[model samples]
Target chain A: AQSVTQPDIHITVSEGASLELRCNYSYGATPYLFWYVQSPGQGLQLLLKYFSGDTLVQGIKGFEAEFKRSQSSFNLRKPSVHWSDAAEYFCAVVVSAGKSTFGDGTTLTVKP
Target chain B: GAGVSQSPRYKVAKRGQDVALRCDPISGHVSLFWYQQALGQGPEFLTYFQNEAQLDKSGLPSDRFFAERPEGSVSTLKIQRTQQEDSAVYLCASSSGLAGGTHTSTDTQYFGPGTRLTVL
Candidate 1:
């Protein structure tokens, strides 16, 4: 069985500050990884995904994540976060037969 | 293109009552998925369907949960005898299945706004 762990439950960052959210997964082989964001009362929106190829994958809203096989991690990062970037973020791994396992999610609170 | 859409954006049911959530995937999409997301938690896989065939339903919590995609375009997730634990947002997503013989990394999925289910 595959599982995902997000170490942080909540994080606060000031505007214009760099941010990084940690994510780790346990899978037998290389699995499809994805990052999604959700605002209050809204459905999740895909931020980025890593299937194969370049370790660093860029996503919308000036976000990116690096797939580190050695670390079993796919951490999302941003050079500087905007106020509107605050939301709950999730990391997911696709298991066999197209089933997905999602992390507990990290709630980001942007401070002015 | 219009993204996936879910009906009855909010549903409130009493305990032991039955509820049905609907999902309308993107037109011509071959794959559809249903997920459950509790408050302050990420979404959990509940079921998956390819066309009109349900491929996987192992993630459903119990027998009270049932899902179907009769014609392959629209799907429904029905919960009989709802419980407090069943209170969560139900999300639906659709993808254009694997491209060629290989899966494309960009086989991106489009999601609906989700139906929030509250069991009282």
Candidate 2:
């Protein structure tokens, strides 16, 4: 079965520190990858996506993700962490036009 | 420009009761999707619609769940005989369908605030 995995359930980082969230997937073929962030009581917001070109994709709010086909991984990265960045991050993959598979999600907590 | 919107931000339903959630996508958005999000979990695909046509509903958990986009602009998700396990946040998203070929997944999906459902 196709599945997306976010190994870390929760992560903590000091404010202004670099951050990385890992995401891996098991699929028959290389699928479109996406990163999303959700704050309390807010809907999921698209951070970045990797379709075909560019292994590294930049997204809103100073976020970027690198898609490694050989590793079947699409990891998200940020240069610095902010208190407002404390939220849930999800990784999703879609093989076709619809029906996206999502990881369980990782919650980030920014510390002072 | 306004973003996607969902009605009844919160719904409390008794077990066995039926409920319907509404979603209004951005104007001219041709692709719409529904997802179910449990507490602390990522959103799971529930269904997808292109224009008024429901292209894929294989992600729907059961027959009790149904979704429709009659005019290709607004959509509704209905649950029959709700159960305690059915409690979750329902999210609706929309994307411009201008991506040609199988590149539909390349479009960015704009999500609504979502409707939190509580089953009593």
Best candidate according to TM-score:
2
Model 2 global lDDT (CA atoms, 0 to 1): 0.92
Q: Chain B TM-score per candidate, please.
A: 0.93, 0.96
Q: Of the native A-B interface contacts, what share survives in model 1?
A: 0.46
How many residue pairs clash per model? 0, 0
Candidate 2: misplaced stretches above 4 Å?
Answer: B98-100
User: Residues A19-74, candidate 2, lDDT per residue (tens digit)?
Assistant: 99999999987688999999888888999988888999999999999999899999
Question: Per-residue CA lDDT of candidate 1, range B34-101, in tens?
Answer: 99988888889998888988888998999999999999899999999999999999999998884222
List the TM-score for candidate 1's chain B: 0.93
How far in Å is the alpha carbon of A52 misplaced in model 2? 1.7
lDDT of 2 by residue, B15-76 (tens): 99999999999999999999999987888899999999998898899999999999889999
Q: Which candidate has the top score in lDDT? A: 2
TM-score of chain B of 2: 0.96
TM-score of chain A of each: 0.98, 0.97
